[model samples]
Target: METREHYFNRINRFGRISFTIFFVLIFTIPTIVCAAYDIFPGLATVLKATLGLFLILTPIAVSEIVSFVPLLGSGASYLTFETGNVSNIKLPCAMNALKLAGVQPASEEGEVLSTISVAVSSIVTTAVIILAALLLAPLAPVFADPAVKTATANVLPALFGALMVSFLAGGDAGSVVIKGQWKAIILPALVVAVVHYLVFPIKGWEGVTILVLLPVTILGARFLYKKGQITVTPKVAKD
Candidate 1:
């Protein structure tokens, strides 16, 4: 029986080694390409461009990391960084795995389960991307259709809505806050609406959807929980 400390120790070792490999592979190719072409884009310009990118992405990235870590656990965190689609694909896969296994993502058992699930999802996603690239030409007509385009664009909303519904619908589930669902959903809904309709129109913040809503929703839930409006029993916490 592995203790919690042992699990984290192993995870920490694996994370460092894997990320080192990932970092090397990621940067080495770009450096090699520049050397091959004898065209090093100016250092100052590169730094400037990188700074701009970092400024734009840093807030979103930080928000995502904070929001997702509890749900993803340590090993899944490593896998998630390696895989690009955190919000869209990998998260749902990990959450579903936890749900099926009857474990909370923050639990000791969930760490191993989430890691395995994320690994499988990463493989499938990679394979699908490769297949999509190969079949893109043949599938062009299908993707070109307005219905398909509409469905693709609408999928994210549908996915989140379904997830919210699942969380709210589990009234009998002790882990789910029986009375807390509405405030959690509504406050975030308002926040998202303001961001999308009001702030997004101002330009430069279009990329901030779940990133902003995640914190707002959590804050709202915390407020409700503190006020005794939301009932999350200790038994539920263990769940």
Candidate 2:
């Protein structure tokens, strides 16, 4: 039987290898096109065009890795990042799976379930994308309808709101309650709102804002925890 450490080590190795393959494959297509058309942009021009986006996305990427890995586990983190759509699709899927399974995120069972959920989510999302692409022309009018557009626009907020409610209401294993856990978010959320709406007031900077606020949130949570404002109590399981 393989030990847990060995199993995870294997997962890490496979994840790295897979990431490398994907990295190469993603660039290969553009490289082929550029070569075929003899239209290679000089390194400096490419860098100039991408610099701003790279700056904005790099911090967000770092923040996601820092925040998502614990909930997602090793295998799921790699799979979710590689498949993309972490917040909208994979994270929600894994969270729901964990909730349904009543497993703590740091547990072995949770890791396995998270990986399964992410894999299933990826497969389903891919299928949906393909189906939507195929039907796009035929369904253009329906997709363009006012009702559809309105609903589509609100889907993410609605989904995340529901998730927030679930998380706040349901404790780990539906038994261990972390009292005053919501208070931890108060500071971070306030900061983000103030910066986003009052100060910066710009779109597409939320990720950068979050990266900056990460430490604030962590410190606030730690302070609350140390102050005994947040306390964890396990519920007595019934027979």
Candidate 3:
């Protein structure tokens, strides 16, 4: 019993420290890098490169942190889902939490903790990340580099495009599938264009595009799902 208590304490401490460090870095690093670039024109290129490197490395860092403790893995996964980025950090974090608790992964208690831990962790992590991002923004001259800002801005649309492509590619290209895919793609674009031109006098065209496309895409996906054209479910077993 004492050993078990000790283990829990250790795990809790680890979780607290890991998340604290993550929040601090997420809040501080980007601003420092951006400010450094602004102060030194020659360093701007290097700073941008560094920022790009950090973006690429962020997933890996999250993965490493989750891998260290399984419960944290689920928390991380929840974070990814909430953040809309699937970088494979969730399950591992959940697994680690279970291990720390001395619970067999197959047990009911283990399963419950895994789910709960991940969900809780995800919520906390997301809030921290968001706060960090907001805090850091004021420190950096992000708007100074129009090109980098534009590229960073495009990341979400690019991710959306990738998601659409993945959905289409995973399914069979039957008549229904093909038609549904095209409709899904075209309809959203059309709605965004029409909305931008007519209904909403939204300031940012991209924001208007997102506002128009989101509902159209959701409705379109449902239409396809109802028609039995695109089965989102996998043919194989889910893990």
Candidate 4:
């Protein structure tokens, strides 16, 4: 059997190689397109067009790594980032799997389950995408319906609301319950609310806001933990 250290090392190596290949392939598409059309944009023009988005998304990417990696582990993090639709698909899938499996995030069992769940989620997402593409023309009228649009728009909010309820209420069977976690969340939630209402709209500054709030959330949790307000009690097995 491979040692834990060896397993992690192998995962790191694979992640590095795969990410490099993925990066190359991503640029290769545009490179090929430009070459084929002999229509390469000027460097300055390209930078001007992309610089703002790059700035905005870079911090969000870093924040996702900081926030998600611990919960997802090495293998799943790589797979989730590579496959995209992280918040909408990958994260919820992994979290739901962990909850159902009664595994703590960052634990060995959690790592395996997260990886498998993310992999399966990726496969399913790809299949759905292909199916959608094939059905796009046939489904266009249905998709354009106002009710369908409204339902689609609300899907993400509903999904996250359900996830939050499971975590906050500790209602899921076998899911680990952290006592006083809500107290920690109160401080950050208030801060976010204040910022959203008083300072500026959060929608435009989401990435930057998340990066800033991360430290606040950590400090709040730490303070609560130190005060014995936050306790990680082991789940009681049901008879």
Best by lDDT: 2
Clash pairs (backbone) in predicted model 4: none
Per-candidate Cα lDDT values, in order, are 0.79, 0.87, 0.55, 0.86
Of the candidates numbered 2 and 3, which has the greater lDDT value?
2
In candidate 4, what are the lDDT values of residues 1-239, reduced to their tens digit?
A: 99888988998899889989999999999999999999999999999999998998788898888888998999999999999988888999999999888777888788889999999999999998899899999999988999999998999899988998767654333445577676767887899999899988898676677678889989999988999988876667789
TM-score per prediction, in order, is 0.81, 0.88, 0.31, 0.90
Off by over 4 Å in 1: 171-182, 194-219, 226-228, 233-239
- Per-residue lDDT tens digits for candidate 2, residues 101-148, read 888787788888999999999999999999999999998999999999
Selected candidate, larger lDDT, 3 vs 4: 4
Stretches of candidate 3 exceeding 4 Å from the true structure? 1-19, 25-167, 172-182, 198-212, 229-239
* Candidate 2 weakest ten by summed lDDT: 168-177
Give one digit per residue, the lDDT tens place, for model 1 in 1-239.
Answer: 88899979999898989899998999899899999999889989899889978898887677677778888999999888778788888888888777676677788878888899999999998998899899999999987999999998998898888776666653433244355656667887777677668765635553466666776788998988889877764444433
Model 3 — which ten-residue stretch has the worst lDDT?
A: 170-179
**Can you write out model 3's per-residue Cα lDDT over 126-221, one digit (the tens) per residue?**
887788688777746655578878887787677556545654443332121233445466667677667767887544344334444566677987
